[model samples]
Target: MHRAPRKKRRWPKILGFTLLGVVILGILAVVFSVQLNNGLRSATGKDTPVDTAVKSQLVRGIEAKKTGDASHDALIDKAAETLQQTPMKTITEAAGNQQKAAELVSQTTGVPEASAQVVTQAIFNDSKFDGVRKAMANGDWVQVYQQGKTLSSDPDIQALTRLVQ
Candidate 1:
């Protein structure tokens, strides 16, 4: 027996749907690429003024810090000079000397050295030692500390040594 006319297969419908899906994906890709290009352009271009303003502010801040530091150093140097000129013969003189010595230590240790203030404190803190304090006050650190080596056998010194090591 002959067969009736055959119905259309579903393959064409499946193929059409697939093609539509591919076209939609292609459109989305183009749109995404255009958005990315716009974003990059906005990020990089036409921002020269804002960048310059930010740089200028940073430069101003740096300049202000430098000026303040220079002034502070000048004041410290002046104070140190005054303390150094004062003789160290009397107890008061020795006290001032100790202050200068401490300042020297602080200066030698600190990056820029807070000399004047440190020296004043050292002199003010004098009276803790007798002749040795006097020696340090007179800026005889080498002799005074050399003598201190004899006293360095204490547990405090040992503990400090171990901690540093």
Candidate 2:
């Protein structure tokens, strides 16, 4: 006698593929969430621990304006910025380069060149900074962070600040 033809089950294969697709979508969702959260954290306009760092160095510039290091101040600034600028040695060809520091302040803060002299006077070892004085000079000064931006408007300076930071 001829054997009867049997039906193939399609349910198992279909269920397996569906489960795989769900898992893949789930992973993508998680990765996207993490990226979005990080970007938002920095712009919360409040301290959200976007970056917690500790920097130590002798602060010059102004004697009376003396305060804590840049790393700690960054968290306190409430603008999601680390007021501390990158060291001259790390970003410039010269180790104790004064010009680079001046540029960052001038471009970032729009301060008169005459006022930025204090920027060159401070000494740092790799990572260091106290307050705005880290980038200050002479009698008194101001702030700028756009590209150097504690408050930045120039695209060129903004791009430059991003590169350095």
Candidate 1 residue lDDT tens string, 1-165:
999999989999999999999999989866564344334435675323423343344345434433346676565455444334333222223344555455455553453355656545643564434545654444344445564665456576578656743
Question: What is the Cα-based TM-score of model 2?
Answer: 0.24
lDDT score for residue 165 of model 1:
33
TM-score of each: 0.26, 0.24
Residue 61 of model 1 has an lDDT of 42
lDDT of 2 by residue, 1-165 (tens): 998888899999999999999999999866564344334543563322322121122122222232477764553452223234443222222223566666655665567766665644553331333223343321012221111234245565468556854
Report how far off residue 133 is in candidate 1 (Å).
Answer: 3.0
The collision pairs in model 1 are 99-119, 99-123
Those runs of model 1 whose alpha carbons end farther than 4 Å from true positions after fitting are 1-98, 111-131, 138-146
Most accurate candidate by lDDT: 1
